[model samples]
Target: MLEVKVKAGVPIPLDVSFQVAAGEVLALVGASGSGKSTLLRTIAGLYQPSEARVAVNGAVWLDTGAGINLPTRRRRLGMVFQSYGLFPHMTAAGNVMAALEYLPKPERAAEAARLLALVNLGDMERRRPAELSGGQQQRVAVARALARRPEVLLLDEPFSAVDRSTREKLYQEIRNLRRVLNMPVVLVTHDMSEAQMLADRMVVIDCGRMLASGSAAEVMIDPAALRGVGLREAGSVLNARIVAHEEDGLTRLDTSAGSLLLPRIEGAAGAAVRVRIMAHEVILSRDAPQGLSALNILPVTVLALRQGDGPGMLVELQAGEETILARITQRSALAMGLQAGDACHAILKTMAVAQDNVGVMQPVI
Candidate 1:
């Protein structure tokens, strides 16, 4: 368990707190200098907190009421800085071994090799950080943090140095590591896509205060919170597959609702992707348009219909197991007879869905 409520000498007080069950990843997501790093530092004993407390798996690391402030070393925590902080002189194996000094030299070496293997870097254990790519070094840093097997792991933008392709691989590695060692991880990142994909639950923070904390679905799809962050109220994210790509710069996608067409895509045929269709992009229809330019005509059943935080109503639609959002004005909703559990044709132009609306839609870019 971890908790904190601290201020960084700012006009708006920064106060946020959350706990991670062992092996689960809880992400801190917000803008730069939102004091996300400060929150992590406070929990790690890097800074003295004016208020609040820090604990790990039932042990109290910081207690304001008891006036206890343990040194960082005394706290049982594993830290992976944004820079990774790998030693240039040390090989990947050597860096991991340093964290396990309590063990014999032979055991330390074995442990290093084991941790490296856990992260799928068994082949590069002997190579120094300088010899490895940015992604490789970050993996080494993660292995090093686990050599001693601390109760908690703190990662601050650990994948910034890596590209999207490699980052997915690292995500899998982290998932594997969590399975092998049941330690809670605190991941700090600014990218919502990364945060949504990597974290089990997301904690939204701004000005050092917590805005929302819930599963990725609950935290991100809320138009109010997104509006607060200036994110346009796009509809829900739909899981899609690149069934086919056209030579004319359009691609056919197989979504839960039905087959749809979108702008030229770069994904391999038969690859899974996320398509973001904002509610505003979808145009409703009482009857299908016979000769319309709108490419996607999804036959959807409205799961829930309610007012949106902003100007439009939030219509949650179900095509299959997947859900999507359609934002429409109150007048349109009433005129179209849009009601909960109503079946309707959700119409949209193929080109209306922008790249941002497509979650992790790859290869086309």
Candidate 2:
């Protein structure tokens, strides 16, 4: 587990505290220049704050009260930056081998090969950073980070440099890697959707202050956290299991709310997955509407209602044991007399959920 508590007055004020368990991915989410990267730097010992306590699995890396501070090289943590920081002159295998100085020279080559293959880059071991694609270079970086055998892994917007198609593939690769990496992984990202898809839990930060911390589902449902992740991007994440691929090109998923149909998902049936339901895409109805083209209608009970200064309202609903959110006009909410404990149905179009909004559920390590 990784425990962090940092407070500073100068150089970007930050007062954040959070914990991440082993085999868990905790995302630090906020807008650009929101001190997300600063926190990561502090944890990696790249930067020191006025006062802080950074520990990994009971080992103290930094303790202001104790006047103990470790340098970056002394910290047993691997970090992957947005830029694939690779030696252009070195091959992928060589880049990974550079971090294996502690091993016998003869054994380094074999270990590098093993790490490259771990990230599905065995064939590209000989390719230099200049010759490899962006995703491949990122893979090389990941291989090198893992080579350290670090106790914690720090990912700083690792996917932002890749294209959307490549980003999705990397996301899956990270999901696959988490199964074997038995350490806490911290990810810093401004993209809420990415955090929702990849992180087991999230720490919402804004203006150098921590707003909220919890599972992606829990943070997204909080109004305070929504402020950190712009209200425009607010949504709920539901855990589901892929049941089957329908003949009509949709995939059926079994959630607590009931079966949900979405555009064909990539994984095989029985795979656990997360479905992101955008609040703005949902339509609330007091009565089940007939003659609708949409096939997904979930009977839900209004859990709570939050209205902002704007003309819109955020409605929280309980569908079975799952919590869903809907963003509707305050006028519409009033017209329907929506309130806590009121029974209603949530209408969602089959196409509303895009492929990017779906992610493989990370197993609890």
Best by TM-score: 2
Query: Candidate 2: which pairs clash?
Result: none
For the record, the alpha-carbon RMSD of candidate 1 to the native fold, in angstroms, is: 4.8
Estimated TM-score per prediction?
0.78, 0.95
Model 1 scores worst on lDDT over the 10 consecutive residues at 356-365
Q: Please list the C-alpha lDDT of all candidates, in the order they appear.
A: 0.76, 0.91
Candidate 1 Cα errors over 4 Å, as ranges: 1-12, 175-178, 233-298, 303-313, 328-337, 346-365
Cα shift from native, residue 180, model 1 (Å): 3.3
> How many clashes in each candidate?
9, 0
Model 2: weakest 10-residue lDDT segment is 356-365
Candidate that scores best on lDDT: 2
